[model samples]
Target: MFIKNKRVTLLSYWTSRYLLTLMIGLLIISFISALWIRHTTLENRLEMIEFMAEEMVNRITDVSIPGIPPDERVPNFAEDRFRIRDMNPSMYIINTDGEVISSNLPLEQREQSTFSELINEKEEIRKFTSAKNNKDYYAVKKKIEIDDELVGWVLMVESKDKLTMVKQEYGQLAILIVGLALLGWWAIYFLSRRLAHPIKQVAEAAKQVQSGNYEINLSDHIKEKEVYELVSSFKQMAGRLEQLEKTRTELLAGVTHELKTPVTSISGLLQAVNDGIVTGQEAEEFIRMALVETSKMKTMVGDLLAFNSFAVDAVPVKISQLDIDNFMKDFLAQWYAIQEQTDIVIKIHLLHKEVMISVDLIRLQQIMTNLLTNAEQAISGTGEITISLSEKEQYVSVIVKDSGSGIPPEEQELIFERFFRGENKKYGIRGLGLGLPLSKMMAQSIKGNLHLVESTEKGTSFEVLLRKEG
Candidate 1:
């Protein structure tokens, strides 16, 4: 037979263990306290009996005749003569021969031999059991003297049942201990439940997320700092996941359409030429159009592969030190030579100081190319693209500012997210939206960063930071 293990929840786990430990600790303390109270009560009772015995002895000594035997001189004690309020013990006067001369004991307990046998002559206080009544009693004794000669003992005997105060105290103590234990258990039960509640909600939320449901609403009004932070962070993460899911869906449709357009165009153009629909020079034009569509398709495919490789750290970088001023001049000249926009002007503002920076030449070229292309595209009819360079402490910044309408405020934060395109550019742009994100990734790979300094209706500015070589 297989034995299944029982699972304990957070609430039960903490409360049950704490209650067990608390109960054990309370039991140990109560046990020790009960013993101390009982011992102290018994000692007080014995002391009271001893005090009464001494009083009776003094009374008998005062009434005795000189040289008279205690058996004849000592009188029987009256119940009221030595009694202090409600406390009364049986009083006895015994001779030196162990014979009870006189006693205030009742008729049934007045046997002289049995009473004498119960007293210990050497002890001032002792407990003894009577054979006739089979009852326990505490006996306290004081010696009687006449003319400085020992006569007998004045003994006080009280039944153990009369000391019921100890039992009453034990009852009160047990009640107090049990009351405190119950109070502690109640506090722990509620406190453990309060602590476990939020964690349970978070566990359920995690399950929902695993099932691909990103919309989750968790309360953030918790007073605990750590739990509040946990709930707030999970909410933000769910919001981001929801946005990414939407972007992925849009990207799938966009990529399919972008790739299919070129393929369809190429197929139609080549088919027309082969069927002799156009003659001579017209046929050559048709073939040229097909080649252009093929080139566009190749560029798109190359971008997708390159992005995947860089994401996985499969791309290698070859770093080399280059003088900033000279490299910028050569790089801008080559870039300008390829651009067909004659109306757009490119201006350079280089720093007077010579700054040497460690960078991979090809990666830096790619970063500069993407930034310049973006700036060029942002401009409308006739606008200027300013390239300024500056040096600070241990880094150099290359700023590209364009006198074009700035990006919408809402789209600025998401510019560096993969597969995310701005509302304005999604329809007008033909390529995949990987330019800025890929550029940022490459910048980070080379120990640098790229960020937008500011963007307004006047223009937009982007800054690229590179570490200065030692």
Candidate 2:
């Protein structure tokens, strides 16, 4: 069905290999058949012709025609007794003077002396001979006696039917083989498509699976055993597709819950402002809330984009040397108001010494902000949130812990997946699902990682690891 060109399709679809194999097979079979038939037919014809030539020679001597004397006449002849023209003689009878007296094939068989010369040879001669006139003969010349004295000779001339008929029959066989080969071309085309039908069905079924149908019913199409194997393999692949679809659905629900909260809050405050419910101080507070929502939206967008860039293996990293203690101090200064508002008891544990390492500043800030936001959400009413840093021989690690409702053991691993929120956490109050996944992605991008270290019903701690500067 490819529309590149009609002639191209005709050749490509059937393919020369099968056609060639079919052609060669048919050729060999047909050739043997035709050759045997032709060979047998011509051999039978030659045997019959040889018998007739022998009979004709015998008839000429035994049965003498009218106006012919038997005894004193030339006792020999050339050409068969069957006269060329019955009205005259068809054989050449030689006289005592070695001259022709009677001839049936007058122009050709008149060579009675030549027959006499052949018969006089030493060994008994009985073979076909060709004339100087390009005519051939299958004659048997023998000694004929009259009154016990040799007189003349006899020659039997037959046309070259042995070679002629064989050649003609061969032409007919050539035509038959050509016709059968043409038929073989059509046979190969249908056969090739029949063989490829199963492959095509598997491809079409896989396409339907890609269109999100996990339940692929391929019972009717896959009939042959070979085709069924491919179909079964596709069915197995469809199973994995089903699991991926379920994961995608769960991710969507989590993302929606995460987005709906901040959007709802922003809309409520904006609607209040529009209705002139509060002004002056209240208006300023609403404005600040709107800014906070805007900032939240911005963070969500950044997380999603940065995670995608990392997934594609293209996130840029600008590592620098900075004191980890000073970075945390600056980060706490920015979030001091949020901790105070939530009445969250905060504690920082780090050495003031310079903790130089390879890091991306903006990327680290994003990870810390997401972690702190998550920590703040976990603590509903005045609870302790601790930030602690430690350095290993070859890596730097930052740990954030919250004294709030920790993650369930079952949900601990899934929490880092994109758009996956915990079931027990309140959707309206908790951080968006993008935060942890984004933090994990950022950590891995700088040759680091993020993991939930330990969790219980009372608290959760998240660990971030980064390579120390070279």
| Top of the candidates by lDDT | 1
TM-score of 2: 0.45
- Poorest 10 consecutive residues of model 2 by lDDT? 82-91
* Each prediction's TM-score versus the true structure: 0.70, 0.45
Write the residue-wise lDDT of candidate 2 on 1-470 in tens digits. 67774443433556577667777887787778766875686455445444444453454445545322443443333333533221221244454554655554435535554665555555333444555666664443444345456655544344444323455566776787677777777677676666666666667778888797777776646557876777788887787568657866976876776677778889988989888997989998997998898788777777677778888978778888787888888988887845545678789999668877778988898899888888877877789988889997778889999998988886775787777777655446544577787888888887788999999978999999878878
| Model 2: residue 224 alpha-carbon error in angstroms | 28
- Tell me, by TM-score, which candidate is best: 1
Q: Which segments of candidate 1 are over 4 A away from where they belong?
A: 1-8, 20-174, 347-351, 387-395
lDDT of each: 0.82, 0.68
Q: Per-residue lDDT of 1-470 in model 1, one digit per residue for the tens?
A: 86689788989999999999999999999999988887787688778778777876777777735432444444454535545333467777787766777777665666565556655546677787877789988878788888789888777777776743575788899899999899999999998898789888888988998799987878878988888888888888888777777887888788888889999999999999999999799999999999999999998888788788889999998888999898899998899788785688889999866779988899899899988888877888899899999987788999999998988997787788877777667787677778888888888888899999999998899999988897
Task: Write down the RMSD of candidate 1 (Cα, Å).
Answer: 6.3
lDDT of 1: 0.82
> How much is 365 displaced in model 1, in angstroms?
1.8
